[model samples]
Target chain A: PDPALDDAIRAVIDGKTKPLGALGRIETLAARLARLQGTTAPRMERCTLTIFAADHGIAAEGVSAFPQEVTVQMALNFLAGGAAANVFARTLGVQLRVVDAGMAEPVDHPALVQRRMGPGTANSAVAPAMSPETLAEALASGRALGADGDADACAFGEMGIANTSAATLVIHKLSGLPIATLTGRGTGLDDAGLSAKRAVLERAAARTGALPPEAALAEYGGFEIAMMAGAMIGAAQARRAVIVDGFIATAAAMAAQAIAPGCEAAFVFAHRSDEAGHAAALEHLGARPLLDLNLRLGEGTGALLAWPLLRAAAAMMTDMASFESAGVAGKT
Target chain B: PDPALDDAIRAVIDGKTKPLGALGRIETLAARLARLQGTTAPRMERCTLTIFAADHGIAAEGVSAFPQEVTVQMALNFLAGGAAANVFARTLGVQLRVVDAGMAEPVDHPALVQRRMGPGTANSAVAPAMSPETLAEALASGRALGADGDADACAFGEMGIANTSAATLVIHKLSGLPIATLTGRGTGLDDAGLSAKRAVLERAAARTGALPPEAALAEYGGFEIAMMAGAMIGAAQARRAVIVDGFIATAAAMAAQAIAPGCEAAFVFAHRSDEAGHAAALEHLGARPLLDLNLRLGEGTGALLAWPLLRAAAAMMTDMASFESAGVAGKT
Candidate 1:
């Protein structure tokens, strides 16, 4: 970040018709946008939300409430415009794309972007999630795809069954937080199911010690998550804002920040999720997302909801008249 | 609100292609819209934001940071599409209207609606803010205007200099809260200025003890605030949603709730403001606003920022497909 440019943007924001800092986080958001684009006046008119679908081998361990086939079913739901993400995408006028990173079963659709690494990864309780070669390919594929997009910002959503289980283990390994504390009901697990999830995640987390970002991904990450992290880095490299969704997407953001140190400058966290581990993850990253509607739905819905605030912030910077221009008297 | 309709809406929301209660407050918001509209599928496509601009007599005691001339100036700015409210309204596609409730100076603009109750209220620090007749007319005018609007929802914004002091006194009288607790720096008061504002508000609040809604409004209220309260009631009576803005607007909502006991069914608290007393006032009303971005600007910007969430919530109820229709599996 450019300190001088930041000062200049603050000065510009202070001159707006509203009181100093009256716009609250919006003023800060505008400044961040200006700094990210390296301009006093930045535009964030176009946005795209990509839902990366995959399956987790840990689903066999009964971590999530939904069946493994739900991933493919939901991906098809996205294509059919029947899912919450699809409704939000249509409502917000955000371009929606479904990327098949790797589903457990083969599915063919004309609109699905095929970037499969494999059917899925090996069950992490017994072995690493993906091969080293698969990890590198997933990262490269995500990077190329993210960098090639034309939209000014990219919002990421994931639909991998039991992915929250995978995210919890990744978070535990990266942040060194206790595994049981970071684990929660992925969909709607009963008390007994939650206990089982905690047990499974504990066993999975015990297999890893402190490791690099790539190594951690090979151990416990989902194909969708690794790609999301890579995509965030790629988008940041291309100067596009990366709008991170709920828990799983935030895990991707944490991985992205670990792999590419400065890419967080391009991230705008969408909302605080109701998931058990999300708050800790956000706090670890020092992020204060825009919305906190208790949303735990990880389909870019929260990100999509926050998109207009970004537009409003940009409009406040680019369109609102300064006090002098509005011919309004300033403070006495 | 009908309990049966609420149950039916909850059942419908639960059937959507996400885990139960995953949308969190959004599900509550959607249920509210549906309940208010008396339908399982409620539509909130069109919204209008009306800014009631007036001068507050308490401004004469130097209770606010901005000069009283700002009331007229900001109203003109709104008409010129140069204010934050105008920009937000334009960006969110909400129709923006400026009403001269009782500006100290007459502003003759073709687009500005004149609902003048007089030049302004008397200095509430030592006298009743408005005549009983003026309060009645303001309330009636607001009711007619709010009832006549074509939009599905009406958002209220205010631009009366020193109005926060007036609102503080009103809240203290209505809610029986301590004066100092409900007073804050209006616009942008320095330490000494805030102290002085509190003293003035304390004196104003002391001039009347436990007055009724209309009596309290006459004793310590702005024309803009009184009109806003009436507008809220009028909108609620018409089965239109009332989106209440921050501190001052919320004070109006409180007054409206007092006057028409059940009108809160149509009320949607838009956001919590950064103002010191706003949280107490919101708490007093049992309101949980949608956004909490530390905003204190009062020109309906907070309300405007939250408009999309209402739209999104309504869309979730009306547009999103259920799990059965989407052919997605539910919880195990």
Candidate 2:
């Protein structure tokens, strides 16, 4: 990653009139920005937050509290600029794009990206989520529009009713972590609902075993999730920062990393969310998120919230005067 | 807090097209802002960051890595917008006001507040740092200019070479925590230097047992730290949000809370820093900081990083469309 600029970047960051490493993760993020764009004066003020929307077949398992219809409705909400991610994007001046990977119901908004894989995947408790052909189609749909701009970074988010169940099975297969460790109330389920969900997911995990990343996507991944994973791989290929939202989004990142291997170098885990399995996912990925506020929202809201920090990091590196310039004594 | 509006605020927040607490601490902060300003449209775009600069007597005890002269030098650096805090303030668009409380040497800056308490405090290990008279004067100096005008919020920070030692002793006397529990490397001290610092502080603590908050300030407070505590009191009195920096700033906040009793109602602990004694101080205060990046730079840099979150919170509350407005179904 530009070993020549490494010392220069450190000099710029260290020369800022603060204690060494005092700005903490800001400095880390700053260094990454410099490396990603291969410039100390990197700019990330323009961001594109793409929310991939689809429904999971596992909704039939009664795993999620919300109806599958909420997926289509939320995509419409995002297009209408009324969702949490919409507000956050507006606040951070990010452009929001809601891509329809596959929804049980069709969305009519012109703003919705028309890349439908299917109405929804098959119930993974009984059959695989999708055919390998559809999985590749979803992945290709995301890759086609990768970093299609001069924007500094791109964030990935997903919406699928019962998607958490799909993610649980995906991670279990990927990491060999126990299904019991992976299950959580997706959109607020009660004790009975949670138990019922666990039972259904446990059966799915036993049936699927530990499939490869591609096979696992066909087995348990939602179309929206597969699309997001593809989008991340593409963003990293284009050398743009990939911002992962909460649990479901992070699950997409895990899948992307499995396929692309080094895509995580461009990633920024936005928050250590309180979504049940998120901590485990973060731990397995060896990630330290930008914020940890017990957030469970799934629309890249956390990433939008963290967008300002990127600006701060870039500003500190580029706009801030060095010790040599400011005539401030170096830390001794 | 508006007990009557509590339900209303929740309805508004929960109605805002996000999940229940999906925004996490952002929602919590928004609710507080709404309650404090008595409006959902809380404004924090205009911020005044006041950094109090002074010298610590404990520097003579080999408690810090940097020499005392660095304190005044850093103040000049801050005025020139060369310090980390200056960079952060510029990034956040917050106006910075450097208040020279008591630097060992005078600074010539047109923007600096000329309320000098003294050249420096006495070596409190042998005698009191400041007289009760000077302590009162420092407090009055901060209170008199409490939220000088139109500024929405205030952040208090300090620049003293060995202020962490002063803060440790101050917290020890205020909370009766052990010297061992309270002491830490101020800037960057070696193992021998740390041990020597602990020995000197232990003797000082044994010699002067329990002290009231005022007496603690008179004994061990750096003029910058005392001024910061006073500024916090003033900010709270002005009903402006008090953006607290790292360890030294949090120590000042503890002192302010002890004196004013309920000023914390308007407080926002900026970050859980990586300083040795910060966590203990945070635990004693029961504060949940907005950010944590292993920051120990004591120039209000962390506080500036958090300013956007406040803005994001307010924006979500005011600009976001409710479920009804967005025609999205509520949780049922």
Candidate 3:
């Protein structure tokens, strides 16, 4: 952390018209923005939301309510500017970038980033999900996306059917939380389907017991998850604010923290998910997300929702006149 | 709320690519916009924030950390567009109107909405705050502001130094909550200052116990508090989405609910205040604020912070292609 910048910005925020720390988390956000940008006048103007798309082989186990085809389709929707993330990003002027980390089928669109690691990862219930080479490729692709010079901040989202099951297993291994506690209604499963999902995920967790970071990525990580973890690392390294979305995104952030030491500094957890596992996941990371609107959609929608708060925090630091400048009296 | 429009708008929100209620509070906000506009295709293009500034007689009791003169000075700051509200409202394209509801000294500015009920209210610790006629005039003015035909929605905030004391007294009279629970650091009070303020408020509350809405307005309400409550009622009557700010604004909201029935339908609580009393105050209103940023600054900054969310919610309902149109598969 930039201690000098933190001290300078703290004085700036304190000298504002209102009470000390009266802006609450916004003051905290302002300090973080200053630390990340290495200046008190932090600008969050060229923000970007990058969605990594892939298929999870766990879908073959009937863990998701939607077909794996939905992954590519959602990516197409993002490219077509029809998803919730598109609406939110358009509102905040956040540039949208779609990366084809590893979809089952090849996608060729004007905006579709062609960085596929493979068709998809293998089912973790049966064997390790990805080869070491594929894991490295996905991580590199994410790193490339995260370091785009024009981007001052990045909102990382993913589109992969049955990826939540993969995330649950990965979190269970990484955080040592019980698989049952980490499981949730991915894509809105019913009682019977949830039971089936739990049974499958429990088996997958047992199969990939307590692997190291590389082996864990090779074991339970979907291509999009691995790529997102890489993107988080890349964003942090580039000193860009990393705005993570919902449950899957938080899991990816955890993975990124483990992969690249000291990368959590650039991160801002956007919102808490209604998914049962999300609160524990955020708590495990010792993160306090900006909003908790009960969002569970994956396309960086939560991060996009929180974009305004961050922008306002920076704006407050730069634009708002201090009590001395505005000639407003301090507390007697 | 228009039930027919509500049903149609729910269909529109549900038909989006995201899951049912996956957008959570945003879906609720979208439905509210549709209801307010009486159409599924609601527009939130022209938003307005009306900040009412007034002096409170409670300040004379030395209950506030700041002098009463700060109210008029902050009003001038708002007129000059140098305050936090100006910064946030400028960012969000929201029109700002600063109204001098009542202050001890006269303020002159081209942009100031000159509508003072009196120089200031009488000291509520010893006598009534405002005359019955003054209370009526303040409410009517607030109603007039709320019914501005050009504004699609209204964000009500206030800039009254020492108004938190007035608000605490009002809430104590209305909801009968313990005085200690509803009192908080107004503009940053030290330990001794807080203790002194509490003692003064307790005495003031003892002098005026269990007053009705009109009596409470006369006994405990500051001109700004009365006017804000009136604005809430006025906005709700005009079917405008009333975006309320932090602690004082929430207290005004409770006052509005007491005065006018069914106004809660058009109300949107902006964010939770870090004030100790604000959580219980919000709970009494049965309101779930859109954000929990812990903002205590009361220049409509919290409402402006939430403006993007409300606008995006409306935009999502209007601009985004439905799942049927996007050809995205729904949950099985």
Best by DockQ: 1
> Pick by TM-score: which candidate is best?
1
> On residues B72-122, what C-alpha lDDT tens digit does candidate 1 reach at each position?
888888999999998889888899998999999999889999999889889
| Rank list by lDDT | 1, 3, 2
Name model 3 segments beyond 4 Å from true. Answer: B1-3
The candidate 2 chain B region of ten consecutive residues with least summed lDDT is B143-152
Pick out the ten consecutive residues of candidate 3 chain A with the lowest summed lDDT.
Answer: A206-215
List of clashing residue pairs for candidate 3: none
* Candidate 1, superposed: residue stretches over 4 Å from native: none
Native contact recovery (fnat) for each candidate is: 0.79, 0.61, 0.74
Each model's TM-score, in the order given?
Answer: 0.99, 0.96, 0.97
TM-score of chain B of 3: 0.96
* Model 3, TM vs. native: 0.97
Taking the tens digit of each residue's C-alpha lDDT, what string does model 1 give over A1-332?
A: 57899889988999998888899999989888888899999898899998899899999998888888899999999999888888888877799999999999878899999999899878998799999899999999899888985887899999999999999988888788788778988788989999999999988887877888888888999999999888989999999889999999988888888888999999999999999999988998899999999998898999999998988988898999999998999999
Across B1-332, the per-residue lDDT of candidate 3 in tens digits comes to 45677678888999998877888888889988788778998888778999999988778888877888888888888888878888888877888989989899988788888999988899888888988998988888888878876777799889887889998988888888899998888888888888998998999889955778878887889998999999889889988888988888887888889899889888888888888788898898888888998888888889998888888898899888788888888776
lDDT of 2: 0.84
- What is candidate 1's CA lDDT for residue A84? 86
Each model's lDDT comes to 0.90, 0.84, 0.87
> Any residue pairs clashing in model 1, and if so which?
none
Alpha carbon lDDT at A108, candidate 1 = 89
